[model samples]
Structures are given as C-alpha cells and as structure tokens.
Target: METLRLQTFMVFMLSSCGFVLSFQINHLLYTQSNPTAPQTLDRNDASSILNSNFDSSLPVKFIIHGYRESGNSEWALKMKDELLVHAPMNVIVVDWQDGSSGWYFTCSANTAQVGEDTHLLISHLQTQTGLSLNNVHLIGFSLGAQVAGNTGKRNPSIARISGLDPAGPDFSGKGASDRLDPTDAQFVDVLHTDGEPLWQGGFGYYEPCGHVDFYPNGGTRQPGCGLVGEICHHMRAPAYYTESINSDCPFTAYPCTLGQESCSTCNGNCGFMGFHADKSQANEVFYVETNSESPYCRG
Candidate 1:
C-alpha cells in the first residue's frame, strides 16, 4: 500500500511539471514573436514605429498587404506614416511575399492560415503586454482584405476591420464567403475603388450597411495599365482610412460624383450603386473623391 501511494505522488508531480512547462512555452511565444518596427519609420522613434504590447489604452493597428506587394512598399509605408501623423497608435505590418503579377493564386489557400497567424500575433501581444483585445484594429488591402475579415471573424475581440478595395471575385465560395459581411465581423468597413470584376470586386456582393451602401466614384476606374498606373488606380479609393477609423457604423448614403459614375461600372442593382460593409456607427468615415486623374494617386 505504501509503494502504491509513492507511485501516485510521483505521477502527480510529473503532471504538474508538464503543465508548468506548457505554460512557459506559451509565455515564450508572447515574448519572442512580436515584430519590432523599423527604425526609419518616423522622425519620432517611440510612436511612429513600435513592438506589440498589451496596454488596452494603446491603440493597436495592423496593416496586411495585398497581392504582389510587400509591407515595405511606398504606399503601405505611406499609410503607416500617415496614421502616425493622424492618430496615436502602435502599427504592425504582416509580411507575406509571394511573387506573382498581383494576383497570386496560392494566397487564396493561405487566407485562413494567415488569419490564424494574425490571431496568434494578437494573442502574443496581449499575453506579453497584459492588454485586452479591444485595443486592436486591422486594415487590409486586396487579398489581405479576406485575411483581415477571417481574422476578425474568428477572434471576436478584434475591435475593427477595414477592407480597402477588397478583392471582389477571388474571395468567393464557402471558405471565403464567411469572411466578407458586416455580420461576420465585429465592426466591418469595406471600400471599393473598382467593384466590377466578379472574381475581384472591391467589397464583394455584400451590403456595407442596412441602409447606406458606399459607392465611391461609382465603383469603377478609368482605363490605365502598367505597374505604377495600376498602383495609383487601386489607391484612389478614399474609404480606406476613413473606414479604418470609423469601424463602419451609423450607415450614411454617400453617392459618387457624376463624373465618377460615368467612368464607373454600376453593379446593376437598383442600389444600382456600389456595395459597402458597415457593422456599426460611422461618424468617422471619410469620403475623399479627388479626380481619378489626380496627382495624389498618380504619384
């Protein structure tokens, strides 16, 4: 009987040790995985660029790049810089480098995995800094829009998600559809520069709000080709930054300018306008309609 008692005690001690080790492993993930911001980010070192931490008060912003782009591009970097000037926030850019002509096929397969990675990144941020999930916000462009959507859907705590020129057609069907609507996200906002292509519609065939659906420049683009031109075309969508801040709520109907509609391809629904996703109040939504030929986008 004494021998059996000794064996039981040893088993309990071993189990305790295993539990302790597992906890340490998780804790280590928090400490080591958060990426450090680049030093060249801003003249102000502390706020412009930073590592992830869990201060619920500190606003956490994440930027996910689109196809054929990297986190380091001038446009992506410009958005980060602008956000710093506009708001006080910690920014992290997800880097996924897949070489293709902006329409990388493999990315579709990895959308869910990317979302999971985002969850892991946020989890680690919270664990290390002791911050709650409400402090986090995510902004994604093109295919990254799907990634952001899936991430927010899976992790309910994510405060806001903005889809900039969401790749319309590529994110269709079962695995991808669940990540597109306002209901799927806690606070979802979608901006469409060119919402014509079924396989790559800016915001897909979804409602931006119960009443107000945003149709920027009527969701169509003037003809242009080449790398620089294409980049300019995609960036012309004004709703990106506005939706980022407002988290898509209190639906407002903002029609495109006459010229914008002329060049745009209407979705053929009597809403006959474009589509937008609004989950909540939108006092912060921005609508910038500089001409399609404006230098701001061309540069």
Candidate 2:
C-alpha cells in the first residue's frame, strides 16, 4: 500500500513538471465595520493594517482556501460571515488564488511561501497594532490547511489552528517539519473527511496530525455525499465546520481507539467537535456522527 501510494504521488508530481509559477499571496481583512468590502492588507506597509478597521482587542481569525480556490470563494466568505456572527473578530482571508489554480504539485509547493508570507503579516500586525499572537486562530481548508501548518511551524506561539481535511498528496508520510503536525501550534485540531488512499479516490491525509483529531463518520466518506464522490467528501470538512460556528446542536464527539467501530459512547471522555472543540482534549482521537444534510450535528 505504501509503495502504491508513493508511486501515485510520484506520477502526480511528474505530470505537473512544466507548470510551476511565482506566487501572489494577498490578505483581505474584514471587520464588523466593513464586512463585505474587504480592505487589502500588506505586510510591507504598516499603514495597511493601521489604516484599516482591524480591532486589536478582538480575536483574529484567518481563513485560508485550498487548491483551485480563492479567499473570496463562497465557502470562505460564508465562514467569515459565520465567524463574525458568532463574535466580533479581525477576520483576514488569505487569498492565493493565482498560485492555487495551477497544477496540483505547483500549488502544493507554493504553500511554504504562503506560510512565510502569513508569518510576516502576523509579525507586522503585532509590531504595528499590538495584536497578540495568542488571539490569532488559523482556519485553513485542504491545501490551505498545510499552509496553516507551515505558518504555525514558523510561529509556534500561535494560539490555535483548525485544519479542515489537510491534503494528502506529496505530504502523506512527510516529516512533521514538512507537514501539519501537533507541534505546529499551541493547539491544533484537525477534521479528516477524505482519508482513504489516493488510489481509492481520497484527497486527505489519513493519520492524525493534530493535538486532537476528529474523524467524523470514519473520516473517509461522509453521509449525504454519496453521489458527488471524493470532492464532496473532502468538502464536507469545511461545510461541517462552518455550520459549527453557531450550531444549536453540539457536535459532540467521543474518544475512541483508532480503527474501532461502534465507539459512540461519551464515557465521560467527550468533547465538542469543530469550532467549539475544547483545547483540553489534546492528544486524543474522537469520532462523531452527523446528519445527511445541513445542520449536520447530531448533538
């Protein structure tokens, strides 16, 4: 299985040999004052953050998109909206669509620079606005999740990182320094939605790579995504996380041994999944079930 996966990864990289290109990373800030019209943030310009509506007192949330997606994508925007509704925050959408839309390998390679750029932006924000790194939370999906990991690796003081189905290709068996792992942030939580082998049509890493990992519906395929296939399963990570922002039903998850089926009981070892996941539940793996449609939490 390992050999087959490695061979598949090699083929993917070789297929994109001539597609590498420079990256253009952008940070678009949205506050309660300007929720729709995002102000562009530049790490090179201190005034970009100082002149904007960013509130240093508010917790900051950075939303990052993955391969072939932009910060302005519907899902990213929706998540920003949900987060604002939940609480006042300095929301920045990291936009790297130009780099993200190319061949998969090129996009994957671009994540390192994105992470560095983000770290620079955060450092600039702190220097200019007295923004506390402890108040910063990174929420990244797919390749963006790996980007988040990279940033956290550089800035380990970051408070929390929520990885939504981190990409598997070229990163599945990489060292912790090369991919998302528990050491990336003070607290890292991951939701695995498409963890089956690539040959089997999965798009996400299968092993636990966070302080706490949530495997919803076994983490390979999700309910209600039967017709749409792997993409649907992968996308469910963000969908479920967005709904969790203000979900009336708690995404209650119970600790379970890896590969154990029917491990549903709380047994005094449960934690809410998604946005409200408890930081105290570190180094554990949990499982939860969801509904077939929206408002997926089963409480």
Candidate 3:
C-alpha cells in the first residue's frame, strides 16, 4: 500500500516537471550597513558587488529559499535579520521564486542552474573584492538545499553547507552528483525534521547525507506539529535554525544512532546542533529534543 502511494506521488511529481517554464534568479544583498532595504547584486557587474555596501572583510552567508518562496520570504528575512544581529556579515538571499512556483520537478531541475549562478556570483566576488571562499556558508531549505549542494559541487572549498530538511522527492537514492552530499562542502551539516517515507507524506530526505546529520525528535512527525502535518515538520528545520542564531538557549545534541534511546556515555562527544554545530565532528549523527512552540531549544 505504501509503495503504491509513493509510486503515485512520484508519477505526479515527475509529470509536473514536464511542464517547463523559464525562470530568472535574483540575489539580494543585506549588510549591517543596510539591513532592511536590500541591494540587488549582479554577478556580471563587479561594480555592483564591490561598489555597494558589501563588506569584503566580513564572512558571506547565503540564505536560499525553497519552492514557492521568494527572497522576501518571512523565514529568509527573519534569518537574515537574526544573522546580522548576531554578527556583522554579508547575507545574500537567493531568490528564485519565479522559477520555483511552477512545478515540483521544474523547481528541482532548476536547482542546478541556481547553483551555477551562485557559484559564478561567488567567483565574481572573489575576483572583485578578494573575498575568501572559506568564509562562505550556504544555508538552504528544501529544494534550496539542493541548490546549495550544486553550488558546493562547483566549488568544493565552501566552508559549510547547512541543509535544512533537504527536499526528499526526486533527490532520494540519487548519487552524490545528483543531490546534496557530504562532499559538497568542507563541512556539511544536515538537520532532518521530516524523514518519513514519501507515501507517509514526508517531504524531507530520510537518509543522512552530510558529515554531521542532526535528527530532531527522531526526524519525523516533530512534536507539537500534531494536526499541522508534514509541512509543519519540514518548516521546523528553518525555525529551529533561525532561533539558534542568537537564542540564549543551546540546541545541544548527543551522539546516537538513528533510533537509539540514549547515549551510554557522551563523554563530551556531543555537539551543538544548529548554528553552533561543530564542524570538526565528521560523519557523526546526533539526536536533539525541542519544545513544541517557539523558543524551541531546551539547552
């Protein structure tokens, strides 16, 4: 029964991609100097990047939104604000809603181009301002997470790539070249909030695809999401991440297998799950518990 449902969903998603439409991507820049109003960045024009309020000395962070979302997405904006508040840095929101809203497959196919475009923009920044790619971090949600992976594939030196419940459809069972993988960045941290099978209405990838995969609440049907369903569980990835930016509470996670109840002895083997996740811990899986409402972290 589950297999039948999953096959049906896959057919629908694949067919949806057949109806193609052109899409244009935009990069919106926000710096401490200009928080609210974003300056449009043009990868082709060096002056647009170097002449603007962009600070080359600061670290560069890109927030890539998922399907049906724009650069002005509330979550993206909120994250940008929180990041800026936490520290002075360059936050670029990758807006590709024009291409994302058409179909799931279309949006999935477009992630490659988005990644290519982002890579070009980063190269331009490097050439123009001597920006260090090591200081670059890509934070993406759903399909946007795949976009980050594509970008990282083009430039493997990226410091970090955070996959916030990376979209599972069309990406599952694919090779490293096809979807987000551990090799995409120097340090890849994945947060899996919705890992149930597609037949079960899960929208997030179930398998661990990063160097450090953090599965909160067993990575499926997050607590307090009750009647809200999969979307709620999927969006929790970003909500938790955004709060981790400056929250006094810590999202501390303990090392454990996927369904392990407790760590026999963590012995300092634990790592902070969200913004403060330790990059040095490689190929580690951790479990975290969170509250149902805002201020989700339990410390």
RMSD of each: 17.0, 3.2, 2.7
Q: lDDT: which is higher, 1 or 3?
A: 3
Worst 10 residues of 3 by lDDT: 11-20
TM-score of 3: 0.93
User: Which model, 1 or 3, shows the larger TM-score?
Assistant: 3
- Please, what are the lDDT tens digits per residue for candidate 3 over residues 65-182? 9987899889999999999999999999999987777678778888999999999999988888889988999999999999999999999998999999999988998988999999
What would the per-residue lDDT of candidate 2 be over residues 140-226, giving only the tens digit for each residue? Answer: 999999999999999999999999999988799899999998898899999998898776667898899999999999888899887
TM-score between candidate 1 and the true structure = 0.60
What is candidate 1's lDDT per residue for 1-299, written digit by digit as tens? 54554455334222321111111001111111233344222212234224424244667677777655576755566666655654556666666544212224455545566676677667655655565677776777776777787777777667677776765544544453455555444566666555543422223333242122344544445333222113444665433343333332322334333233433222332121112344433422222333334332210
State TM-scores per candidate.
0.60, 0.93, 0.93
Find the 10 residues in a row with the least total lDDT in model 2. 9-18
Q: Report the number of the highest-TM-score candidate.
A: 2
Worst 10 residues of 1 by lDDT: 21-30
**Candidate with the larger TM-score of 2 and 3:** 2
* Cand. 2 TM to true fold: 0.93
In angstroms, give how far residue 286 of model 1 lies from its true place: 11
